[model samples]
Target: MIRKELLSKCKEALTTRQSELIKQVQDHFGMKYEFAKETSGELSNYDNHPADTGTELFEREKDLALNEHAEKELEEINEALHAIEEGTYGICKICGADIPNERLVAVPTTDTCVEHAKNETFNRGRPIEEEVFSPNINPDEVTDEEQVGYDAEDAWQEVSRYGTSETPSDFYGDKEHYNDMFPNSDENVGSVEDLENFLAADIHGKFIGVAPNHDKHEE
Candidate 1:
């Protein structure tokens, strides 16, 4: 019940923030559009002033990007509001824990915790050197075409003159192995078995079925 109250409060605050941002975006677009159009009109009557037209185009382009980004944010906030209505608000998608109050306050539209945020990923699906820092020389120059390079295996072979053709194991898969070693820390504070007893089969009208961690954390 307390958690639900907190969730509602957080949602309300986010609603307010989103509303404010929406107003700001609308005002910006409205003001910029009028300014650009007025400038263009004034330029059309001028003896010779190409700079005004250029300025208008620049403002339109800049506003276009801002509008796109703001629209995406508005959609995300709407999704978060819808989630709150559907009664699945504060849960982290990655770990299934109740995300911290601070995080919820900071990013109401966020589906993951600060640690699991999309921007904070450490090891992507691809391996280290092979993934991003690919070799094949020509580092002195760059081309605009494809920005990819050869695999780390080839680079290692070329540099060391000794290697096998076997592919390296992928360490970034979403496999469910090695889960038993680390229970959900947020849920299992004391004896894990006792904590398991506290988790409910139904979480605030949300039914996540048959997952081992879900069973472990159900109140």
Candidate 2:
């Protein structure tokens, strides 16, 4: 049985916490309402820049998340008050043990003791989306067959060919010119096949040798 003095202390703490949470909920809802009113005027602007619209969307999402968190905290506080009325406020709901006085003072809304409370921490499970769509594969481990189709490495290479921010000065090794700045540029034949990599036909139907490292005029 809980001591009458400690029970009274717990009741005082719970009542104070419940009042604070109610005030917080009211404040969060007021902020949310004001944000909605402000954003309502921004929605009908066809002439607004894309960046302006993006900023408005980001602010709206932040307000929504804040309101949700405040609402959840208010719900927990209400549950704690109900537990106090039922005469089970300081008892650990999970382990059926007396929660320490210090723990109760620290977190008045929680009913679980320290041992059981550890299990309620952030979830360790992977998201369900990861099971459906796998993360990016290692670029080096990608097979030649995989390169033929739409692969992550292939997609990166295609985008890199358009050019990047890195200049010849930023290249790791000996880069004599701008062309040498690209990764494996000396041997980076654009095609999958060796023949296509070295040779290309002209508009006149004449085969032109274009191999960079090897002698094009070799007999």
Candidate 3:
């Protein structure tokens, strides 16, 4: 149970970091307010000009930015701690691999190993952890006429508008097979547009819609 012990230590370290970050946030804000108060008081005297006000502003701004980022890390760490407690901590969100200890030490909130983690690129304003499994679930690749909400009425409408009403019957081959199956009505090149045209027409016929632009034409 070395993983368990490391996980606990990692949680403790993160909690300590969270506490430290909160104190730093408070101290930085206090420093800024105190400086501002002093500057305002001196300005009220009408002749007092601080020599390093610009430098102070620059330093304060940078420190404020850093503290905010640290605070955000604390948020992720808290989430990670909860996940650990819930016994859902080490499983990779993408490939279901056991996350390595080194990675846990480096980024305890992470839910994926390096390989799967590489597939997921995202930006964080602070220390980061990512969960890349949910929206990208199995068959996140399902792209079809049915997925785009297209029915025969829509195909009928497109054919009636651009080509011929008879084209729908000829294009789809028969109405009975596809009257319930629907058609692709993507705003741009649709599923129907791909298999029906292009150099890969024969390939598409053999593979339904695996034409060159199958993904592009996916509704």
Every candidate's lDDT:
0.61, 0.69, 0.60
Better of 1 and 3 by lDDT: 1
Compare the candidates by lDDT and give the number of the best one.
2
lDDT of 2 by residue, 73-124 (tens): 7788788879878988889998899998888777878889899895647778
Instruction: Report lDDT (Cα) of residue 203, candidate 3.
Output: 43
lDDT of 3 at 116: 78
The regions of model 2 sitting more than 4 angstroms off are 27-40, 121-153, 157-219
Query: Lowest-scoring 10 consecutive residues by lDDT in candidate 2?
Result: 210-219
| TM-score, model 2 to reference | 0.55
Better of 1 and 2 by TM-score: 2
**Candidate 3 or 2, higher lDDT:** 2
TM-score for candidate 3: 0.44
Error at 137, model 1, angstroms: 23
**For each candidate, what TM-score against the reference?**
0.45, 0.55, 0.44
Models, CA RMSD each = 28.8, 8.3, 21.1
Clashing pairs in model 2, backbone N/Cα/C closer than 3 A: none
Residue-level lDDT of model 3, residues 1-219, one tens digit each, is 227688778878878877886777776555556555463444443443455656657766776788778767767878887877788787787877788888888887787888877565576454333243223222343353245444434445456435343434445544543322334333333344444444354544564435434544574
